[model samples]
Target chain A: MSRRSFLRGCAAFGGVTALAASLAPLRELGDYTNTEQFLQKYYKELTPSDMTKVITRIEGEVERQYGIRPHVRDLKPMDGVEFVYALNLTRCIGCRKCVHACVKENNQSRSPEIQYIRVLKMPHGSMDVEKGNHNYDSKQVPEKGFFYMPIQCQQCKNPPCVKVCPVNATWQEKDGITVIDYDWCIGCRYCEAACPYWARRFNFTKPQIPKDKINPDMSYLGNRPRKQGVMEKCHFCIQRTRVGKYPACLEACPVGARKFGNILDPNSEVSYILREKRVFIQLKEEMGTSPRFFYYFDK
Target chain B: MAKLDPSAQKKSDHTANYWLGGLTAVFFSLTIFFAFNSKPHVAAQPEIPLVDKKFLDTSPWRQTYADLVKAKEDLSDYDCYACHDKAKPPRIRYDTNQKIIIPKEHANIEMSHGTHERNNICYNCHNEQNLNTLQVRDGNVVKFDNIPQLCGSCHGPTLRDWEAGAHGRTSGYWDRQLGDINRLSCANCHNPHAPDIPTREAAPGPHYLHEASSHEPSKSHR
Candidate 1:
């Protein structure tokens, strides 16, 4: 049988051979990527074995393109660790440094729809969080009792997105983060509707990041560039967290307010914060999403 | 010339009886073979995974492995229920006693088979081969040292922040060269089965640590 036909048969059976068939087309198109940047993938098409080859090729391409041999492979998923994230609302400057870092770290579509982080500017006296907006373009710490609340997926324990998936395309892992299988999703919006944070965003168009800025260190569901018409959200930096590293947002936070660690480990910093500081979750009374993120307002 | 012979009549009857006996034997043998090969699935059984009321009586929200084992031992010899029926769907159970409904952000979000469900169910992600590794299910096949990238299927934004070093667990400094340990799966920060209540309250802040002398009108201005 032709490779495409063979791949179709493999897909019917559910395996990586089908993925190889789809990847074959990309190899031909690899020449088109003169900029030597990263390519996106459908999550279901790849297996762990396929991912290694893809990662190696990407590293070679990154070296060929940028001449910088980054420790990309060393940053792959490890065997026993569980990664988690935390944000301290007390010190965010509203400078959006983390937002810029995310844009650069992941080859995100510049389209306003694909923004991973939305820095909401709240008014000075009103803590009625409902008033924040992503469109506010005023100066830094723009006047009055205003503070910044960077809104994104809270990575809740009982993700509404995971529960409502008809095809079981999205789910939570042992480490506490929720993920999606790009290939398995039939473009159904059930997960989006179920998300109380409105954290889920649909990709209406294939993401277009400048070729030079593509981050080579990517995981299937993490930093890898995505195609059009799929739903995606925050990954908690799976590529870095898989190793003993920090996320892009935490590194970029200027005030050092964000803290991330294992809630399972009582000795961790997040655990300490949970113990010592009085923390509250947003919209705690409705859908029961146990978010890992925390916001502390300072008087 | 001869109208009918008794011997000829006897020969015809014998031939007909032989064909009928062969057909009956073949039919019965085929039926027995098919019956054995096709594993019997009782269609009469309802769609619910558990038929026993005892298992259902224990917990309305979550199912335990012990319960699964009990249900399997009680129902069938195959123990199918041990693996399939034991799936404890993560849900948000509002504690009316605390006067708190689980937050929507903390609730089970519907993911259309794109995330964990797309992978084999709870048993598939967690190792089932060895019962000795008990308590929380461990992901053996897709073994991630830390939180697996599997969480990013839906939480790409948080994962991105984690990568950029913003949201999750972190050291005091941002290092692009080194990877971060704080980035985790959905379960790292939150519970899969029990929806955790959002306990943090909004505290007021004058958060920025401004350089003390920067705003104090410079000596030149004075």
Candidate 2:
């Protein structure tokens, strides 16, 4: 063969090998399609029979992977119930008990350390979150002129995260909780960028929860074992809250700084806080996304 | 183009069209009926009880105070009757000769409620007649659980806030339908002798990316 033809042949072989190597990852995509997950419909679009089949398939998959039977359900929001949260700034003693409680209850990824609640220690008189410090390691809290403010997914009524989702994966529920369908999320992280509170977290790796520490009480739209490359945030503890129980963070708070309840109920604690105390939402002037979470000080 | 009966041909065509139309109508009606009649696909919410009643019962303050009071009120070791009978006890009098003198038996007790000079005596809070119980402004004897009423005699506003679920820790349930709501008594959080909540090491804060680098003391202090 001529030298030019021989070089062309060599180049052709190299191109073919590189192409084959890159396409090898497509086999994993093929595996997803082969399973029942590819046939899964959008959460809102699922028919009764489709839901049953999808849930059963997920149960089987979880059992195969985790070696533990998880009871995963798609809990519906109750009618006339708008959940609201209020934190007493004066009462919060800069204790990070709520942060760890959220991690355990929500089945957050343990390896890279994802916590829903971020307690920011702000200077005593300032409300500016920009000046707020999240990594304050003071020896004793309420450090003279500083107060702790814990921030979580505000569960906004008009969430920017939901708006920016390329796939209709994340959306606000009727009860005002913004939930992500782990199966449906494309892991684009657009929602993460859109969120103002830094509430959304992207799972970089498949969550490595200890088999013993795994929260078996899982919900489909809430704290079920999330796969890698999906965005997850606080769903107001849908597994517990939908069943008429308080969120884990509220139970874990040592100083009773957190308060949560259905705002529609006239007698609910949240309603009383809104009506009585000097209550305000974070970024209230932002105007578009009306967050259900409120911060208040005692009168 | 064979010679045929026109009426018969027409009749056959009419019958076929009628049957076709009738079938389409039936199919559409069935679809509509099924669409409307099918029940909503509400995912079966398993009745999983979320709250652990046992965990709720274990209040941080309740157990501590209960244990503390139980240890002090161990009647087997120290009896209140040994010092005073059922009749009203005498008012504590300070001897002019001595600059400061608490009873030798009660010397170990610390009276740090307000100040050393103001209302430092035991009779101020404790019912002299019954050393074991507390006393309210109305002279009504209050139980340990009802210490708030005694504290309310002076700190009325705080008592009101506590009742309104503002001043203290409330756990268990916000909606009373699921479980009993628990409110911590004043003694649960505050020591009766030392009213101020003591300082303690705060829990570790969030360690976000570059958070350590961003902690500038000069900027934060400003």
Candidate 3:
């Protein structure tokens, strides 16, 4: 071909390629086919139309991935079923049943480092909090003056994790439960580090769950398989508890050490427990976490 | 300048043109190489085949999630570490990694279980499933794996504390609402080797050396 004609042909080819490249973002925005690659923004940034589209996409993705359709709640919290939990330190057997339940129930990655609960084992007769060790070892109960205190997300009424999230990735609902928008979280780890109880865990990698083993019973907000590099914490099993029933840890504790009920109802079991027990929360003074989880030693 | 023969003039012109073309070509080639190398390439890798033979032959396993049915069986067996090659099996990490040493004759039965035997393993209470999932019974889907039901599966009274939010850590951002959200396995906390808490060397002890007061009004000093 002549040199001038060849140059023109080359220009045409380059132009077409550039057009395709430029249109890529628009194509994704119109229809989020590549949900995995298309990272979502915080709830505050989403418009009503954007939210509708995003929610539709999320529901579709959940069905595609898990084979089960979850009822994603768009409505606000109900008034009466205010979820709550309590722990009896005296009755605790130091068995880590609760921690394991959390891993499986929350669809957590199978890593020891990501455990939600850290049972601080302190020597008997010692009031020093600094000396307590979370790394306890025992085959049976009572490692010679050591008692178990399982620590997890306190579901604080005034949650610090919600306050520190830069993107507002996490917040408390009307019922005093802290919730996280996993897609919006930037994996900053600020919330993780800020939690005095070390309750919040970050998905350092795409959570590893055996496909066949994937828990079909997952809520959009809780226990769904999470993507890599986002912060997550206990949601008090909103999918389950909001409907009624009990928590996994409460069911698993061999020593009758856990309790749960509605705090809103003065006649509920939790209200009674709080009224009768001399209870205390973890790190109450420094942070004012105002946690709903309370602990009392019966002895 | 003297008039030259046609053949000689033609040969001189060809040599000059050849040199110019060669220089231009060299410059363009270098420019193209650098420009192409600077841009990033975003491409997806091929997926792993489902068959076992293919998996075994593959040099590096691609990111394929495990089969769900097989995974349920694996969960029952507690063999999570087998496929995840990165996992180091839970070992006793302190004091030569042997059986934990608790000082004998210490008061507190909860701490002194050297003789009293405990029956439950990791799964008895933590179980094959976690509490957050939906349970369908008799054609009805029941949400919330009540702590009482699971704890009552093993320990009856513990369910009471879980509901009251008084048995576990009360400070983190996890539990307290619904009680069903708490992690279940006993291994999540209370490491099986060292039961005693770690002590800080930097901080002073709670008690300190005291000196007698000389200015006491009607006491021993007076």
Candidate 4:
């Protein structure tokens, strides 16, 4: 071969080697995306043994990372139970105890803090949520002309978030709770956009919870530690409620403003509220989500 | 020769038909007898009784409140019987204008439930005869847990609402069959003397990614 042609070939070979070296990091990024995670079946599609394997794997991962053994369970919904929540506006003293209780119960990320309940301080005479300030920093609450209204996942019968999911990760349970499979989620943010109440929260980073604060009693579909880039919302405290316990938020409200019960049971507190009180739901006219959460004023 | 035996064959066929008829009759008789003799099944009783009379009856509102308070933590520290054992405490002497004479012991208590112009006496709700118990409008004594009855005498509508799980807080199981349920008493959230819950500092607000951007409009307008 000619000397000039040899020189040109060497230059081309050097350029190709440099380009391949720079692209090596992109290939390493693919290593972080586990093939096992990608190939994992949907939550409902998993067989009993497959579910056990997934649960065990999750438990191991959590134990390794957080140095705490999480009791991950896959609790199924009970029959003849439809949960409903009611808030007495007159009784809510604007104390946000419910918010922190929910965070603690749900194993929410403590650093980039995530809270399910958002209590809005609205003007006393108005019912508009837009005018409501969730960031009120006043010294004393029930501030002269203000009333508190807490907003959380309504667990709608016809959830808009479930409808917008590209991957069928989010679905409504038999007991009227909408749940998201963190593993199955694609981080599309479609559910976040579709939710009218702003109930959904996107995990921007891997949840960083202290070892001691991690709620060991977690359900696979509920308060289990979530991966980065997934959507999560309130699942009606499924870890507790599925086992016939009250939601953490209801137990935390000092003023006794919150009421939760099975709507199907005639003797349940929620049934009494719905039957007797002039109960009204938030954003009723807006998309007809038929939310189970209700707000009412008592005389 | 074949024609001679035809009558005999017919006789045999008639005998077979008679036997079949008798068997059908016996079958029908047995069916009729069994159908009439069988007894109807009764429904099994529910594991937990459905009717909770406390939730249903509203006549003696004090009883309902007592049942609710039973599930809650008792106020062991606030023992009224510590001072009053048997005899009723002496009444606080009042002036002609109905101004209360503050006793040395009760000097700390400032009664301000009703407006200043109205002559609101502590004895109106307190049992003068028994200092440990509270008094209803009809002068009946009620336990501290049943203080709702005293409050309800004036606030009838609120009592009704509280009974129906519309006014107060309810915690625990939605299905009371599964676990215990608790409904807060009137005194649990409100001070009976003042009745007005004071305002207090609320919990911290949401810290979101775009919180700064969202608050700009409200700040500029304000």
Evaluated against the true structure, the overall lDDT of model 3 is 0.55
**What 10-residue stretch in candidate 4 chain B is worst by lDDT?**
B49-58
Per prediction, fnat is 0.04, 0.31, 0.03, 0.42
Number of the predicted model whose TM-score against the real structure is largest:
4
lDDT against the true structure, per candidate, is 0.53, 0.74, 0.55, 0.75
Residue lDDT tens for model 1, B51-89: 122211211223333344546644342343454435543
Name the candidate that leads on lDDT.
4
lDDT of 3 by residue, A143-166 (tens): 557766877788887777877889
In model 1, what lDDT does residue A144 have? 48
Task: State the DockQ of every prediction.
Answer: 0.02, 0.13, 0.03, 0.15
Choose 1 or 4, whichever is better by lDDT: 4
- Residue A189's lDDT in candidate 4: 95
Per-candidate TM equals 0.47, 0.76, 0.53, 0.76
Among these predictions, the greatest DockQ belongs to: 4
Interface RMSD of 1: 23.7
Clashes of each: 121, 0, 80, 1
Instruction: Summarize candidate 3's per-residue lDDT along B1-222 as a digit string, tens digits.
Output: 988899998898778656555544554554455445434343332232221222112111111112323244334333443432333422212245343433342222233222342321322332224322223232232222232343334344544554544444322123235343433322223322222222211111011012224432112110
Docking class for candidate 2:
incorrect
Model 2 lDDT, residue A243, Cα:
80
Task: Write one digit per residue (lDDT tens) for candidate 2, span A174-286.
Answer: 88888999999999999999888999998765566667667778888999888878899999899988888888988777677788889999777787778878885555447
